[model samples]
Target chain A: MTNPTAAMLVIGDEILSGRTRDANMHHLAGELTKQGVDLKEVRVVSDEADAIVAAVKALSDAYDHVFTSGGIGPTHDDITADCIARAFGVGIDVRDDARALLERHYESTGLELNPARLRMARIPDGARLIDNPVSTAPGFTLGNVHVMAGVPLVFQAMVASVVPTLTGGAPLLSQTLRVNRGEGDIAAVLSQLAADFADLSIGCYPFQVNGAFGANVVVRGTDGGRIDAAVTRLAGELGL
Target chain B: MTNPTAAMLVIGDEILSGRTRDANMHHLAGELTKQGVDLKEVRVVSDEADAIVAAVKALSDAYDHVFTSGGIGPTHDDITADCIARAFGVGIDVRDDARALLERHYESTGLELNPARLRMARIPDGARLIDNPVSTAPGFTLGNVHVMAGVPLVFQAMVASVVPTLTGGAPLLSQTLRVNRGEGDIAAVLSQLAADFADLSIGCYPFQVNGAFGANVVVRGTDGGRIDAAVTRLAGELGL
Candidate 1:
């Protein structure tokens, strides 16, 4: 069977505005790849209610699982939790368990669990909390969509907490051969290899390093043997 | 006047497979921000025709300008040109101008102008070529979408060629105030500052530096004076 498909919605103006270069998407992409989940699409949208809700619905409907990052902080701009609730037509409010967790963490840290901190306790109806070991503020998984924090450390912790629980297929495997030639010189052979190994995804990423043209030919599929064969054949053909 | 809105479509399997991290998105976002072109959304999809076509249509229809990177190379998987033609229901073929550019560049570089290299000459009908200073292969603009190479250097070059041509509003200005407090402590006052300066987008990005909670409050708007005023008000209100 094919791997479980997934999509990610990155909700934050910082990313879109060039104020921040997002590390979360790259981190999640790597994590999901290891988990054997196929992340088909990733959309970065500014933190707007309508955009978040629309993207959540579209991604949730299209993929087997949806993952979101950002817009969960205790600030005025953090509206991802509310937007997820609206997307699924679920009622959301401060949940006691979440509040207690935040309350306990804040009390121990000598921080007040004020209204702003309390916003972190809002949970959508019928949602399970995704544990965040980095910070006490928890992320929640609502139906097929897993909502997580934007901070790299917190997002990684939440992904670790949630990914193992999802059903996964065979681990996605890949092999690469770096060719010391332009993509133009390597394209034809790569194309033939791609056609021969139809099940595998053969991609050529060309690069210019030190003013010399080269490319990395990556062959990916669930079957490690097929990937090995493709890489071997490519290396032999390229005489590399 | 509101800045012209833009969206970016990143097409590749390497990115989805976690083999490569995209740099073009961040580069374009910064470029557009400086140009006063509001980058509203960014979507990363694999090298699939249907997904690429659907996203092309959706983004093209939604935004004033759509910038696409990747899938424009000479590899067999580089189907972006064909997909763009199909998305707009237009015919595409190698144009004389593009072919000549590639022919001259390849000849000068002593690389054979093979069929794979010739593939770069294909341009959708009614499209205008965007100059690529880094590489000879030209990116093209069709309708509202500007399709550029996935390579960071080439993509940035194409962006430079295209962005200056678009009608831009006032430059997006911003100033940040660093608060040595947790987001929870700063949230209430930040909310009031946001409301008071609704025209300026006041964004609070929190951080944990050496185990101390802190945040950077960024105020952005077309008017530099307004951004400064919002930051000043926020700093005063926070007693900083």
Candidate 2:
């Protein structure tokens, strides 16, 4: 069976403004790769409600699962929850379970459960909460879309909580050989090898390191044996 | 007048596979911000021809300009040039000017200009070359899409060559106030300030520093005076 496909939507004005370099996309990509889910596409959009709603609708329809990060805090700009609610055409308000969780967490710290903080407890209709072990403010899974925080640590914690619930295919296996030659010098043989191993994917990533040009030829496939055999042949051909 | 809107398409399996963290997007975002180009959206797709072509067409049609990075090298996997041609329904081949530049660069280094290396010389029909000062392989501009190298240095160089030729609006100005309090504590006043400065975009980015939660409230607009006024008002209300 084909691996389940996934897409990521990153929403933040900080990322779009170049004020923050996004770390969540890279983290999610790696985690999904390990889970045997193919991350086919990733889109970064501003924190505007229209943009978020449009992206959420598109990604939800196109992929088996959609993971979103950012715009889920207790600030004026944190409108992701509302946009998501609108996208699904669902009624949203501060749910009791979520509010109780937040209330309990803040009570221990002697902080008031004010209206602004209560904004985090807003959940779309019929959605289940995704646990946040780092902080009591929980992320939620609405349909196939899993919405999480913009903060890297909290995002990772939520991912850990959500990953175990999803079904996954066989882990993708990869082997790499660093060839001490430019990609041009290695392209012909690499092409032939790729043609020979039709089921495997051969990717050549060239780099200029310490003024020396070379490439890392990576072979990836679900079948470990096939990937190993292909990598061996590739290494022998390149004389690496 | 509205600022020229742009979208970026980053193509590479390395990025999607979590083998590489993308640097070009952040660099381009900052440069475009300084040049007053509104970067509205960014998409990262794997190194597949169909994916690249579809994204290229979509972004190019939607935005004033489209900037693409990666998949332009001389490897078997480098299919960006051919994909761009297909996306625009134009023919592609090794142009004489691009080939001449490559030939001269290789000659100086005593490297043979093989077929694999010559792949870099391929340019789409009716395209103008974007200069690559760091590397001799030229990036090309076809229609509103500017294709650049994946390597950060070369990509930055190409951007420098292209940005000066494009028409830029007034540079976007931003002023920020750091409030040493939780977003919940600051949200009410922040919302009021945002409403007062409806023409300017106001964003609050929450952060945790030294175990204390706070936020950076930023006001951005083309009108420097308006942005400054909004920031001043925000700071006064926040008592910062």
Q: Which candidate is the best by lDDT?
A: 1
Highest-DockQ candidate: 1
Worst 10 residues of 1 chain B by lDDT: B225-234
Candidate 1 has what TM-score? 0.99
Model 1 bad stretches (over 4 Å): none
Native-to-model Cα distance after best TM-score fit, residue B183 in candidate 2, in Å: 1.1
TM-score of each: 0.99, 0.98
Give DockQ for candidates 1 onward, in order: 0.87, 0.80
After superposition, the stretches of candidate 2 with alpha carbons farther than 4 Å from their true spots are none
Q: Model 2 misses residue B32 by how many Å?
A: 0.3
Q: Model 1's lDDT to the true fold? A: 0.92
